[model samples]
Target: MRRPDVLVVGAGGSGAALAARLSEDPGRTVLVLEAGPVPRFPPGFPAELRDARLVPGAWPDAPTVRAYPVRLTPDLPYTAVRGRVLGGSTTVNGGYFIRARREDFDRWSARAGDARWAYERVLPFLRVLETDLDFGATPVHGGHGPVPVGRTGLGHPAVEAFRAAARELGHPDEPDKNAQGVPGVGPVPTNSAGGERINTGTAYLLGALGRPNLTVLGDCSVRSVAVERGRATGVVADRNGRRTVLEAGEIVLCAGSFASPHLLHLSGIGPAKVLTRAGVPVVEDLPAVGAALSDHPQVVLEWTPRRPVAEPAGSWLGGALHLSSSGGDHPGDLEILQSLVPMAGLVGRRTAVPGRPLALLASVQTPRTSGRLRTVSADPRVPPRIDYGYLETADDRRRLREAVRAAAALLSTSAFGEVSAGVVEPASLDDDGLLDRWIRSRLGTSQHTCGTVPMGRAGDPSAAVDGHGRVYGVSGLRVADTSILPAAPLRGPAATAVLIGELIAHAMCTVR
Candidate 1:
């Protein structure tokens, strides 16, 4: 087996970004192995599918080329979506691009004992990888970068109404959410340029494809990380029914939250009980490999507009509202995102009759409940058990209730009243209990799954990866995707994942 300088598992957002950065040296050989093919936005796919692919479900839940239907459990009424394509979830996520809140990083640093992860320290990496469209003599943004960033156009009428409603609710206009540390209602910054998705693969991998040192293998599923004597040497992958061993000096797992930890367990790196129960040998008794899983659980607050102010069009809305919980001083707990999309089914199902369009959207930033992903079978092909313990805490329920109230208040404002019919979520706004019931029934995931392989101090038993992203108790192995996030940051995880790739590339270059 020929060894490359680096072998990246899961050529998603993080892997693509890392590959692009490492290829810049022209001397280091980087091999990216993807379990799925490169995603091409075919014209035949439904508009809803395209939009949902951008928002959620970019990662295929099944191990096939076709997109499969996702089923939601009782606890999590919303669909669980993931991308199986080369670009990963970024290819299918809503392009809403917002940086992680300073408070989020501060909390992570305090909890993980890594002061270098402070907001100020991470900003340089964020700026380097981003190309802010709203940049011009602004110190807060970078204009000349690979990743394009821009705002949605001001053509939508709902955008105006949303902004007016925010102002009416005492929220100031924040021109740029990516600026230093401000949060308010403004145009959503997206990764879309020229009305098309600019995913990580497009921005990173595509640009580096000409490099001779970088080898990209799509449609190849990595079965397990090949670990010998507590060190990762390469991976065992299945490509077109043929098994092959791809050797590398270092192995980095960028397979998102669920898959990364599952792969670790498959390679004998998880809890002894879990590995033993699955009839697999336990190379390490790391109980925290698949623990500390967290995601943003949201509750939909639907409302119908009275006068047709340009009826709801696409799931992608131009404007949004960022509100903090009533009790919390920092803007991290809960948020209210207003979208111009009707909610009828798992995917936005629209009716032909043009009576009035419904707008249903919610943001649940602070979640009290956490879940774990455990392998049901020792077979690498079997899917892991996913239990999203939604609304399991009084705090989660309270925050959700508050989020609904906030959404309702925004709709009731004078701005929305001009074109809004009435409330649709709580049917009867007077009763809080009724609203709570509606919340529990209609709540779903925001598709931001993270925190499975948390990064913390070396002595921390729960920490799967170290501050530098190297997997603990294993050499030449690291987890560089959302799985390394100690917690889901305030903003979307895609951009942060890109930053993680850049950080990892720099770390690897320094060590080499």
Candidate 2:
């Protein structure tokens, strides 16, 4: 893996795809470095990591996940956990592989000042990333792709009730959540198969393993990107407790929302004032690096079921309702996701709830609030201070408040009555003041972090990277991850991250 033609940092969701696609050519050499080590294939990983129903990352002692202290609000302290192992968050998530709404790419295209990012322009790449089990070989979805996309394979009584409740409440039925169809209740597209989370590592990397030109090394921590002469040529890493400087013709970072931007800061490719304050020589004074943090600020509503909600052996996230907020310009901006099983064990600590619980996750999909990330200290080990300015705008607060109330209504319907249970927390969301306080106190994140390195045209001072993810002030370096997203997608980012890898990989190949 020495002097690989292409070096991908962080073998998570996007990194796995980037390495897999770039290494397709036998002539191109690729090396992927991951900090967290786990079995690349089945039987090697622990049981909790294998199944999405387990919600492995929430466990206090889980090794594959890194829990970082982040502020969701002024006084609300939260833990923003990011997957550290191969396949990234996909390994630890609930297998909600829903695609980014078409509107998401519209803003991306607008910010980049390029039409190539438009939904129509990017649909083919989207098709290339997934094999849609529900609708295959269609004009909109792919049939033969590396990643397998299926919908609500598990049967849960509550999921059925949730769907029925949506219909009873006059919401349309959206069978395929991945489609460009209208917002409504629908099955959550999952990337799992045979009860195993088929993460990007399994879908893209595993298939291309053993290739002479490809090497994947886990437990290798990249201390900094080696940017010499204002160009990224390689990375200085700690491999097996030894300092190693590995060079590459091109370096791509797919370390996700937080880690990717964090790496750029460590490499001295960030705001001049911040890096100088940290005592690190500036490689590039990119003001936008880690400046515009966008994400979904979500709150959980977990309740105890009438009886012990019989557990099911399937994907935990089975159904969801996407609806527009009152007076909102966007569609499906307010979300209420239904979990097939009790979620008290998963995120109950955030809500101060404990016991077998049925849950509804609500959030404002299009938050106007933008947060910031700053490298407080030069030490690479010292994590950046992430100030997730959640619900800063009155509009965001209103939309999220509506979504939470909608979730309560859904739970009150006869559909939920079948499994009728008592409320777990916030005894009442009766008044606006009380609800707002509850929201701030229990606020959390979907972990769909984006826009740290905003994508825009050259003249735009806020722009850090170009539309193709090339760093503005550096050469031989590119980023293909959720961090490049101008904002969080309406649904989730798992599939979008894969699409980004395929899109950027193709662009890199074309340029070569």
Candidate 3:
């Protein structure tokens, strides 16, 4: 493929959505290059990927998955799992599809100097990407769109107790958690419409395959954006050991937070010193391309429910609770999630505490600590080094410690009296020091990675991309994924990633 109107690298959530939206304009041709295989049939996407009960795609050793090594601490190394299939990490994720908080957009707007990124401006783009089945025709939700989002719908006894417990603690029950900035306990809105997961490939790419102007080339790894004279012309991709220069009028990097910056560095578009050390020639010395990596830090706690769970085999996550740490009127900075399934086997090689049948996860929504992504080599096949730098800051440790304490309190509420027997971990939450030690040992990723190639005001030296996903010091090259996020949103980044795809497509189309 040569000289297409637009070339999109990595057909993950953002790339697939951008390609589909761009193809709607019949005058322009779009090509999406993906590192994973095309999930041609329903069976092509593995049963584990379809099952919401298990995070099979999260297994680093899984044959179908690609896991990156992340150094959470200097002594501890954890695997950051990303799906290597058509829909990217969406294929392997738990399918929690909630929008970013309004403050997230407001923050982006203040930094990027682009009001288009503000909550009111970006909400329309979010609406264009989803067909909300549960909350139809709301002021903040879309009634009809490609991706179908609805409540988990599965009713479990323990989940009901959890919600009631939240209400007892003064957090009201929100009918739709995705609605206009509601901080309360409610059923998790999932991307799964029926039983199967609704990923980007299923929602955006599959139905649009018949479009003549759109082409999806899967099982292809994009080496780098082919740049000449400070402008991107195309990408160098390798498919089955065959290297090809797929040229385009405009190149969009949607390889995600980890891969997007890696691709940029490989193409000589990152910090000059790092590129030189990696034996790559420098094209543009942008200091922040692979910097400022951020993800939600979470600690999982298991409990022993005294009564039998109604449906243990059903959906794992029954509901979620969003609360503020400062007790102010802003969106929640802490999230406590309930999972009906046992998650002892999920974390790699952890001793399982017996008698714990239920899982409760607490995540710090706005993490103060950030990390970096660096290249081991110039080779695209070589996975980059990921250091999440979790809980490095005094603020992060303090907030996360408080979050753990909050989760423990929520479990001990009167509502859990009918369901839970007692806390299964730490032996006792009575000692603050013991609970803090337990939290640090068990902290894990919420799988919401963002802010590597962050978007900022054009003049800001730390900004990799300008307000509208265009990389600094490079033309015709833009990043349209979670990697472009300036910070981790209050909720999961998937829905916000989709909104970004829509917004960027609109920008690219009008620019053309």
Candidate 4:
């Protein structure tokens, strides 16, 4: 085997896209190492991964799901379902592929001090990643690309009721949910086609499979980045219990949000205290490696159906409505997503609802409260401690209160009344104290985690990576994944993760 020009860590959504895009130039050999199993071709994937609708831990549980135990509020212990396969979470995600809004990029650009982070500048890259089946002709959408995107599960009666109720509440219909769409009700643009989950490993890496310049190795977990002096030389990895040293000209960490920071902590590139506690030699005391944790905190509002509805045949999610919590303060700050069918067995029996519950997941998009991701042990096999400080601030609780209030109003509408009998338990939005407590009790993740390794300029003590996705205090190394995002975008991070990989690859190619 030849030494690769670029060694991408973790063949998830970002890593797969970066590796495949880098290999476009046959001269530069690209290699990707994924902790989970990855197949060379689409057919090599399992049947569970083929369906775009079935989330691994959702109702009628499917295989190939890995759950990491984390604390939602220190009091609330939750297990986050993550995809351990080649495509990362994309292979198992519900396929919500909505792009981050312009406001989101404005924050990114300002934080990173780079014009390339501007929404307009990054728009072209997003267009090149997906072939939108619904809105391809649109100027903002891509007509020919690797990933296939379209709308599904909208035909359900519950989905229709949710849309009608939102319209009744005066929320206008914004059909296009991509970059061009406004904050309103519409079908969610998903990266699913023909009932199959067309994830990055299958979409972006499909062509690079047999290419001479690219090699994707799965079941190979990188324990740490081998940083010699100030440059990243390679990685210390274990492939099925056998440890080995792999060298590359440049290294890229694309291990998503949770694992990427964990890798950095293990590599002794984080806070000195963490390194000392883990008993690892501190290489660089970058205190920002696992700081500023941001996630979309979600609270679900359920309604028992007036007339019983069957289990949904397609995707659980169909339509979503975006709103501003504080008018004009934050655009698209509140996302009221509809789960058309109840996740009866999503979490053992805890998710079981009465009368086929129709759920509306109210997620606080722009949360003011941030948390921390810390290392508790040196062993890479042991997961890190995640302290999600959700609803810790009065402002965050206020935003979530508004979302719950909005969702409750939608469920009470006549359109919803036709389908819903009444709101179930925790409909206590009448009192501010009760509503605040409700927000705390139900606080959960939208599965969109970011901001651990924030993108900022040099001398910013709170930053871990730079605008060009390069890690500070390290040479010939970069991180192109969700962890490098300045904050969690208003939309799901699925599309944004792919966009990050594409944008980072373009930047690297330009530099080369």
Question: Could you say which candidate leads in TM-score?
Answer: 2
lDDT of every model, 2 decimals:
0.73, 0.83, 0.82, 0.83
User: Cα miss at 257, model 1 (Å)?
Assistant: 0.7
- Over all chains combined, what TM-score does candidate 4 have? 0.95
Choose 1 or 4, whichever is better by TM-score: 4
Please provide TM-scores, in order, for all candidate models, with all chains considered together.
Answer: 0.91, 0.96, 0.95, 0.95
Candidate 1: TM-score? 0.91
Model 3 scores worst on lDDT over the 10 consecutive residues at: 345-354
List candidate 3 segments past 4 Å from native.
312-314, 327-330, 345-356, 367-369
Prediction 2 TM-score vs. true? 0.96
Residue by residue across 1-512, what tens digits does model 2's lDDT show? Answer: 46899999988788998899989999999999988884656666677777767677676457888888888877778888888888888888777888888888898898899898999999999898888887888999998999888888536777787888888898999988888799999888889776677888888888788799999999999888998787888999998879989999999999888988889999999999998887778988999998888889888897667765655556777689999998858888888988756666564322213345778999888845378899977788898999888877788788778988888888878877777675576667778778888888888788888888778899789888898899998999999998888788887888888888998888888975
Clashing residue pairs, backbone N/CA/C < 3 A, model 4: none
- Over 235-312, each residue of candidate 4 has an lDDT whose tens digit, in order, gives 999997799999999999998888899898898889999889988788889999887788888988878888867665
Q: For residue 460, give model 1's deviation from the true position in Å.
A: 0.6
Q: Which structure is stronger by lDDT: 1 or 3? A: 3
Q: Candidate 3, residues 405-466: lDDT per residue as tens digits?
A: 77778788988777888677757666766766787788788989998999998778889997
lDDT of 2 at 227: 82
- lDDT of model number 2: 0.83
